[model samples]
Target: MKKIKTPISDEEISELQIGDKILLSGVMYTGRDAALPQLVELIKKGKTPINTNGIAIMHTAVSDAGIAPTTSNKEEIESTIPFLSENGVKIHIGKGMLNDETKKALNKNNSIFVITPPVAALLTNNVLEKECVAFENEGIEALYKLKVENIPGIVAIAHGKSI
Candidate 1:
């Protein structure tokens, strides 16, 4: 396993390969299906509050208790992945297989996908701090900014030259 610190660059992303175990530390954001579409809509309206460039987004609605990876196969999330990548999101942390189109988008956009294990308590402990950033009405599906330390995961997909 490799230990990776956040604010990751394209060069660091290129070094990762599918199936490589990783422990990531630093800042990451959390957003589920509800928040993702909202983000895309905000971007389209030119009102995006956050600059996603080079950021990693974990697929979950975070709470003080913990966070768990959500499945990516849902239509809402699956469709949002491409748009998110196009908008400069570099790392996606979630559980389950991403659709082929999303995978293609990741490769085309030089982005990667990491699969978080299904261990909520462990993941929670890794979260040093969390704060809701947007869509407060969505409750658990709200966007969150998180400071994490040694969060465990594995690369499910890597940014490649070709799909």
Candidate 2:
């Protein structure tokens, strides 16, 4: 039972490949579908109200009846991810698979998408604990530091490859 941190550096992420297990020991912020548009809009205007680079993981999630399950998620991570990645932000944590576009973006931008094991929710329950997690507007929240592996990605296809 080990806790993984987030908000790693490019060098650290570089040490890791498409599929490698490693621990992330850092703070993360939770925000998802309903919240992404605002973030993107802000970034479009060159106004990032919140500095995402501080937190290790920018979780696209929400809380419900005392439970946090990631709802509808998207890979259109521009404003935030692209700008954040350009600004040195580390990881983009989300549930399910990222579109080929995001995978390409992350790979091109030098970031990694650490997937959480969907089958084992309670199994990693210990990850949520008295870790003293904090964020703007959301205040104090419990987070599970998951050390996960990644999958292969391709942003563009070659001459013979079809989308």
Number of clashing pairs per prediction, in order: 0, 6
User: What tens digits encode model 1's per-residue C-alpha lDDT throughout 74-156?
Assistant: 77777888988888888899888776788889998888999988889999989888888789999989989899999998898
Each prediction's RMSD over C-alphas, in Å, is: 1.9, 6.8
Minimal lDDT window, size 10, model 1 = 154-163
Off by over 4 Å in 1: 160-163
Candidate 2: stretches off by over 4 Å: 1-6, 64-80, 119-163
- lDDT by residue (97-127, candidate 2, tens digit) is 5455555666676766655443334323424
Candidate 1 deviation (Cα RMSD): 1.9
* TM-score of model 1 (CA atoms): 0.94
TM-score of each: 0.94, 0.59
lDDT, each prediction: 0.86, 0.45
How does candidate 2 fare on TM-score? 0.59
